[model samples]
Target chain A: MNTIQIRNITKAYNGVTALDHVSFSFEFGKIYGFLGRNGAGKSTLINIIANRIFADSGEILIDDLPATENMAIHEKIFCMSEADLYDTGLKIKDHFKWIHRFYENFDLEKALKISEQFHLNTNLKFKALSKGYQSIFKLTVALSLHVPYIIFDEPVLGLDANHRELFYSLLLKEYENEERTFIIATHLIEEVANIIEEVILIDKGKLLLQGNVAALLETGYCVSGMAKDVEDYCSDKNVIDSDELGGLKIAYILGEKSAIPQGSNLQVSAMNLQKLFVKLTEKGGI
Target chain B: MNTIQIRNITKAYNGVTALDHVSFSFEFGKIYGFLGRNGAGKSTLINIIANRIFADSGEILIDDLPATENMAIHEKIFCMSEADLYDTGLKIKDHFKWIHRFYENFDLEKALKISEQFHLNTNLKFKALSKGYQSIFKLTVALSLHVPYIIFDEPVLGLDANHRELFYSLLLKEYENEERTFIIATHLIEEVANIIEEVILIDKGKLLLQGNVAALLETGYCVSGMAKDVEDYCSDKNVIDSDELGGLKIAYILGEKSAIPQGSNLQVSAMNLQKLFVKLTEKGGI
Candidate 1:
């Protein structure tokens, strides 16, 4: 099996359940967007998958092999965490060299080339780089590693619009060059809406939705019109949320969408990914 | 004059020029989006306006009154900085009390109401709140103050979608209740595109573009077609950037858009705020 299978994983901290019987699988050669609200147990799940922490119960399998405390599976997955983990005194080039020595699949030449593309000064110490540069450095290491499954947590935390565009284009180029699984965990949904093929959304420590991006987005839509007409149309629909401005109204509806009635002044539009995520999670995690 | 006039502002750090003879005026009763890349002197200008730092040259006038070390003008302008300046040991309610005692325009009741709306626990100490909740607490204080001018620097740093929506709605409500000026310095351009009336963009420590959001967006657009057709059509336009995907090409053009040649098989669409920002800044701050 070429996949990371998470089976019934559960974790608790100080008696508070963070993950409750969560089960999911990341298949090979796909781009996934892992999304959730803050404190939604996303970090906990990522930590468990990276072998940084153990779950209270259940297990993780990378390619059908046990992942718990398994040193053999270390090279199969690499997680670029949000927190800085490099030594502040070491220069960027030194860190790259250390990574190359530690990981058998680290591509030194590719790392150097990517660094030059991002204009990252390899001679600057880790502590001397700005926040955006620090994020760039972490992503550089992740991109250079020839791992089967790589996860990026808030990869563009402090990046500006230009650098972010550059990163996305480079990521796309890398994905095209090789077919591997790339799981991105980020809050900037709109920016990644077009890049990610699949989405896994968790809320309150439980899986809410997981499916192909196109199919998931097709499951819901929005209706806008006069307040009374929109309310009447939404009465028999699965309305997630709505907004009112004077007499105008717009209601976000989930489930199989129905066609508008004839002679009605109603308008239907497809809801974007961020709006869908917000509406789904705002309803207490449906 | 109900305006904050910044005349010939200049600043440097250890001989490195951060702001070089920059001048702009922020009129009252409007919301402005202050945007720029990293190390673009945005924070330096904000700090100078908030009286946290002194400018190397020039002066700031709030409604024609000198803002330099002027204690009497303190109540007129309030800057909600990204950094945490409150005492971590104090409870959320205690901090509210302190603000009420210090600023005569502070509204304790409004602050409590806003906190309740965000589900922030007033009994918890500042240190105990999560990052999202910390942002909520800070925004609550900023929203409740009846200052004529308010500035928010990365107001939605760690906030989730629901909280961000709530904050924007609340900000609009506050603005509707009383007309005042708001200067929001943030990298999230698309989110604030509708909220801000005008935009002030800086790059390389100089003013790049400043104008109303709607008007500025009209100044640029994107055209898509075959590579040869797009290249031919862009020969006379002010093309900012172009992307080639296989045989298709999309060229981003600035300035007055001329009519497309008849039967050229080219499609035109308006460029979004984030895309415009990226293209403008990526071209070496033109």
Candidate 2:
């Protein structure tokens, strides 16, 4: 099992840096969440990794081979993205045939089976299908590839709740059968919070945090009580954010929580991934 | 307080039916989730109510008054839809001004304030902004309008996780202050599951279910045990779906939960909205 190693990656657009010499490595067989703000260069980095675009500097290595222009590693990675680079005139069945010509490991029969489960008519032209079906079609193709690394950039976009749930289940089912890696970059954090084994957080073209999902979730917690009592307790600690409901105040604290004295009128609860993400990215006084 | 009553509405495109005798109403001052799969007629019904398209038959009454091009009722309803119907050349400020010209009650100050909070550049032309910003700009305008019923068709289309969280909080904050109805038609059901007061589900151009969220959640549960034990227990019940991980079997049952004999080797867990929707719409012998 070889890992994708990204070393000192840097890219710029019109003199503005998009990736600031970032370095990270994605292991071979784990589900990871690549999170960031709207324009935080998540797509840029992903595009660079897929060799669709070039980075200004630095290198990407699939084990020991350089990734760019190397057909050896190209088949090892597949990306299901929002870009409409597909042949719109081609029917789903024809597209599957087209993908088969590009990737030797592509499975046309599996794609057809998955499309049936999604209720997607394989005879319909790509452009004729609605937005949700288009996404579903792309996902079906992506999952049919026998690649070591698959990246999904908002793969569930425009999908209804039922379809989204089906996708997650299918993803888990596939993961359980193969030793492959899935880098899912999405806006629905809570939906994937518990599913992802590892998290790579990016903000404003930089890495904010990266670690195990469980460990990161344990980094912060909420302490709630009377306004004055909570304020006094959080005076010396790193409080990420606070919520106020009438006389009650809930303050989210970062780092390890120390022992609380007896009879302190404070309630502690674990912070969920959504709350942590919101507080980390929230501007002052929001 | 008024309600948007949809009575026996029907529509079709070309030879295919879109909405088949759909009838439902969104009450004033409540947030409702209009749920459906792709091509399930959610957008068709919403378009008919917003007067964007003409229904083949039936009626929509805004407080007992016909809502077809009736200026009195039109001003009371505002829809932030996915269609790019805005003038592209106009800046954010100019668009707000244009809306103010048409909507006498449109608050320009509120729009500007909300835009600032979203960090949206108000001087850029509508066409220059990214997809996420476009949604934010639309939401800013929609929230500024003083109307009895506001409809959102995929409001958070391209927003990031942080922005989506912000939108939900802001929506609840606004609803708390105003006695207005919010009919949010979205694909991201779980995001709005807890926030929405009611749920309206549709499938195959027909009404599936509509009721309070809590009541719907209580309608089903998951029972798990050994394969034989679970199958035997579910033989006399309404089983929505079931899963088998190795020898352990899990069955999702709908309707009232009955008494289980002691040491029956079954565990019952509550069902979430997403799970219930998937089970109901899922087509197969899984």
Candidate 3:
């Protein structure tokens, strides 16, 4: 079922339209990748959905009901933005206590377990912890909230490789047990591509594409070979982008392997989500 | 000729060893990747090389001359750290003026062109700009400096995709023209893998590996297939990491293709720099 839906949503700041008639629906029991270039309305859409900000026009619904300042609907949703939302002077334990009271499904056991694993200091004030530790604190809350609809906007931004891996594994485990809806907005596409079942592409405040992860990978190919040979074979095809090194070239094309011509001496392989995203958002001369 | 050399360098902070008996040398005209996790002594090493900090023990030489707070060797090196060196209250143009006066090779024309392309406001104060813009300003100075040795530590922390591409292209153009040495310390390995000629991996305050990029890629492989097949094939090999999805599994192994046994039904391919780094640094089993 569609857990969240928006129709003709529009948001503007001064003279600029941050989101223009953007419309999409989120299905339950699936992890979705909300992807776009920086400032492509991902955060704006999340804010509107979470009811933190009102859209200039159009409607939004959660569970087939209007999401207009409805505390019941808001209680079911949790939005974890990139910015820290902790009170600077408050102790970490106090912040946790407040969160536990705010969310009905807050799991204290899970929070405590994560804190132990991360080696968090509950006695320290929020401002005293390092940036990485602050991120861990925020993540602890988000993970423990256990809301039906959880949104994470670059949750692992400052985390090291070890912490990032741990975050992904923990999220996967939680999803397997809870079957909750998750929407992750991040620039680290390749890392989460395997975890996300659904992919949503947004560009210039418009919905570009949405589908299963495997389907998107089947549509694009990365061809590597001599620059001249690659360019020649990529003619008449949608060559999204190319990276050159000396005489060799790797071109990311939006087409199946059959579209590539024979005798090009090129190596055609599946295009990684990150590489495809970079190619699609490239500046010029595709 | 080696442009920068470090012999048994050791540093400590409050009796805690940050860099332990580190020794390395950088050549004249190659792009090097100084890779490590956060707090892996990358900043300390760079500061010592730039003469901003003194090593507790051992010696550093730049251009065959000791780097002992000597203005001569310091003038030939440029280090761009996260800390802002410009006066925060001054306008962008004024900061450029200061940089032009301090660095003999600073190119005002090139800087102006890049600033225009990046849409940076010359009249805006450094403190008034956004984090991303501040990073771009620093990048502009580093690019224009044209020093014999330029070191960038997490240069694109807040930059988006478009700006990162522009920065990489600009760095390449400068390298082609001047043949100077560039050392980049960052965690975003895959993004810069194509441009980096050499890779230096540091783990737990010690050097793990350092060599050409192509050689590293040739050694690390990612194999994917049935879970049982993958597990069996990876049992005897050095499996750096693994990811499971339903009945399928993928494992990143460090070895040559010919080492694998037949009848595994596995598809092997080269591993990405980021994936390899994660695998090598992971503490436990995948």
Candidate 4:
């Protein structure tokens, strides 16, 4: 099987640990959501995998080969980080040409087509483009590259509503047409909640949860009713989080839901991905 | 009445029109979502109101007083934009002290309390903060200010899921405790779908739609059924968009729902805000 295995990785900066013994394997041919709170080691780990930075301990294997200092392994992965690494003085079209020279399998035709759809002016320099269009330009190059795994770090930053919609639709189209894998790290969980097949969450440099998105969501149920009734019913149950609206209350519980007594006012429904993420990573809720 | 009124506002840059006679009034004590596509003039209009940029024509009034270069007008509004305007070498704590000096109503006590909640180290200089923490600091300052009107331009740019959740909860808490107006411009429509009471949509530098969110949603409905049957039924109907998957088809329609013939096998559901937005602004769809 094709997979990128991260084996017991750890990284620190100035005595502050950024990643702590994180271990996980991202399988090929699947769309995964990499999630975590701020400074949660998501970026550090992605940097390590992309070979932009090195970890203090452990190893990363790209399809069973050492990823560090291996030029061939770098060809298998493409990371589109939030930082713009392109030369600012070069024109947009020229940058595309440069990327074409670097990646043997780059699709220059598709990149130009995407730029047209985004209404990006190809003649302008990289520094001349607006912030949103700068992101669009980088995304265009990333999507058109021919790689086994493409990791997007906050792909939709500075984008507007219409462009964001267009990006998602285009991404879905690409997924349906190609066999490549996509690993997206973004804060807009609700938008990608339906697109991602798998979910991985980290907190404070530790893996908090990893599973199929649908199956994980199925295990979360919100029980809502009168405040006193919800409070009493959740007294002995595994309630992850809750909310209050005057006399009404809703408690989020985990695991298989049990039946309520007949003629009860309580109601149960599945918890959404965003709500579950908040509860799972919340300081006191967990 | 407390309000910010934009009358016949128009702006252009390098012979390209940004805002074309845009007119709108933002009333006090309500949360509003300002949305548009890239280069659609959302930022241009906002900058005009905040006095960051000039409009070729038209005027803005803050509580019936002219806002153009009026020093007192700045006191009524606080805008948190995407650009980093703070001195890079100054510490976060010193920046807060500087802001206190600039704004007579600056709430230093509240800012300190919020920093503690966000786990921000005030001793770190502005240049030393991560992109996400920089955003956190900006949001911390914006939310704690005592201005009557606050505008956040992409407030949660690089924030994580947990920090975003905390920010929204804190915003709602502040809203509940005070009488103020918030105008937020963000691309994550679904995240703010239920939070904002009103919606304002702009496209190609012109106002497209504006109304209460609930009333607008009531006019959008989606119908789905077998591909052939859906096509035959919606052939002449006012369908905004349609999607097909295998033998199944779904069509999005606007306006009030109509009675369906018996045994049609068509399923109807409410079209959500994000889907409606995509269909409405999608090129060639409207």
What residue pairs are clashing in model 2? none
Question: Candidate 2's residue-wise lDDT over A144-255, tens digit each?
Answer: 9999999998888889877887898899989999889999998888888868999988877777788898888888888888999899888899887787767989898888
| Top lDDT hit | 1
Better of 1 and 3 by lDDT: 1
Every model's DockQ? 0.58, 0.66, 0.43, 0.69
Q: Tens digits of per-residue lDDT for model 4 on A1-286?
A: 4898999999999999999999998999999999887788888899999888999999999888877856777678888987778899999999999989988878999999999999989999999998789889988987898788889888888887778777878888888898888998888787788789999898889888898998988987889989998988788788878878679899988878887868778877667788788777886224
Superposed model 2: Cα runs more than 4 Å off: A221-271, A283-286, B220-271, B283-286
Docking model 2 quality class: medium
Which regions of candidate 4 fall more than 4 Å away from where they truly are? A222-237, A242-251, A259-269, A283-286, B222-252, B259-270, B283-286
Estimate TM-scores for all models. 0.89, 0.86, 0.88, 0.91
At residue A172, give the lDDT of candidate 3.
89
Best by TM-score: 4
RMSD of each: 3.5, 4.6, 3.3, 3.3
DockQ rank order: 4, 2, 1, 3
Q: Please, what is the whole-model Cα lDDT of each candidate in the order they appear? A: 0.88, 0.85, 0.82, 0.85
lDDT of 2 at A174: 90
> What tens-digit string does per-residue lDDT give for candidate 2 at B188-258?
87778778889988888988888999888888888888999998888899887787767989888888998
What fraction of correct interface contacts does each candidate retain? 0.54, 0.92, 0.30, 0.89
Over the stretch B1-286, how does candidate 1's per-residue lDDT look in tens digits?
A: 9999989999999999999999999999999999998788888898899888999999999988888756878899988876688899999999999899989999999999999988899999999997678888988889999999998877886677778888999999999999999898887788888799899998989999899998998989889989999999989889888877679999989988889999898988777788889877877565
Taking the tens digit of each residue's C-alpha lDDT, what string does model 3 give over B1-286? Answer: 4568888989989888888888888888999999877667788898898788899899988888998857777568898976676789999999888888877789998888889988888899999886668888888888888788999977776666667888899999999999899999877788898899998777666677788999889887888889998898887788877878789999988877755566556777778788887766665222
Q: Point out the higher-scoring one by lDDT: 1 or 4.
A: 1
